[model samples]
Target: MTTNTILFDLDGTLLEMQTEPFVKSYLVEVGRHIGDKYDTEKLLKLIWDATKAMIVNQDADKTNEQVFIEYFTANSEWEREEVWPLFDSFYRDVFPTLSHLTYPSPWAKKIVETAKAQGYRVAVATNPVFPREAIFHRLAWIGMSADDFELVTVYEESHFTKPNPGYFAEICQKLGVQPTECIMIGNHMQEDMVASTLGMKTYLVTNWMEDRGEPQYPVDQRGSLEELYQALTERTGVFAQA
Candidate 1:
């Protein structure tokens, strides 16, 4: 029998928040900080443009961090070094304050504890878009702390983001586990289900699903955390009879 390792997504999976409201709040606040030079509307558009550029950024010549810095610097009048500190400040202070908009649900916390108790390696496989500080803050909003995870990917440390099979591969490599022994449980069809293509088990957390472009394989899908937790426990031969 294989030892089960559970990989989770952060934003919509563990932490609950309405996407639009959270984005609106984040952009509004970020805009205020940059407004001394750039207009709010323009700043928002620039961010979207930069994000789009990032999605297609596959050049071996530059890393994502470099690409973002280059794009950000090219579009703004601020010096490169100045931009980093400003963005870091916003992420550290203003980002955590957004935690007020998130609510804690018992199921998320319960599942993490159950997985750990069952001797599963529980890692947060959230896309490495934000810094570790931001990731911890969001986890705290859901009543889960860094101590709950065996591994948590942060933007500064990871070179690839999900939907890219390399990201899934890297996680398996780091954990010293085979792809078949791991299970990815996440809300995004494209990001989470990508693991299935690489021979890993996958669970679709439908309650907070995002319609990624498309999924390459069929996966075990569930609508709630309770259902997912039960399925995993049963599969791993760790579920106790009631």
Candidate 2:
């Protein structure tokens, strides 16, 4: 099937960064900021538990953010109004500091532009475990913005997370396209490429590769951002003008 929509994973694929270190830094900074009121270890554990709940969530009534918030506050002594603002503040202030761990890819802007110019709808299919504020900040680090994509999945807007074929299906539903009409470009083997299970074409980006195990999905293409740019240009005959 011909591809009309392209879903790009944000962290390691479009924005250059090592996922492990970035995540560690994020957890540490968040823990330190909220340490005075909450036990650092316990708080971190709660965050993970809440995140896992969001991942496996199959509920259509509640969004991933709602699921996380309910799970997080219900299991803790804190109230949502009190704790959520603090988390938002950390994302606004402390999260930007983590940008030093990431750099903008030279081909990032070109790739998105080329896809759009070639008549493909673009969306950021980053894991929806993060709030919109955090996702927006990360996009800024790469010199992009939420305005760059047709749709951007955030915790508040998504019901499922990556590695779940349902997540891709939900996105396709939102985009009003068939799964076969969408192409997923991401770095992780398990998380991103699993979109293939739903018939969406997959591209395994190797710039900051995350290998989980032997490949279980078919990748229609694989390469660095620069290589992807060239491939897209050749295939779509859409190039950025000087």
Best by lDDT: 2
The RMSD of every model to the true structure, in order and in angstroms, is: 3.2, 3.0
Clash pairs detected, candidate 2: none
User: What would the per-residue lDDT of candidate 1 be over residues 40-111, giving only the tens digit for each residue?
Assistant: 686578666766565566664554566666787788765767556767898887888887777668888888
**158 in model 1: Cα distance from truth in Å?**
1.2
Clashes of 2: 0
Candidate 2 lDDT tens digits, 1-96: 567889999999999889999888889899888978878898789999999999898888889989998999889877788788888889888888
TM-score of each: 0.86, 0.94
Least well predicted 10-residue stretch by lDDT in candidate 1: 233-242
Which 10-residue window of candidate 2 scores lowest in summed lDDT? 233-242
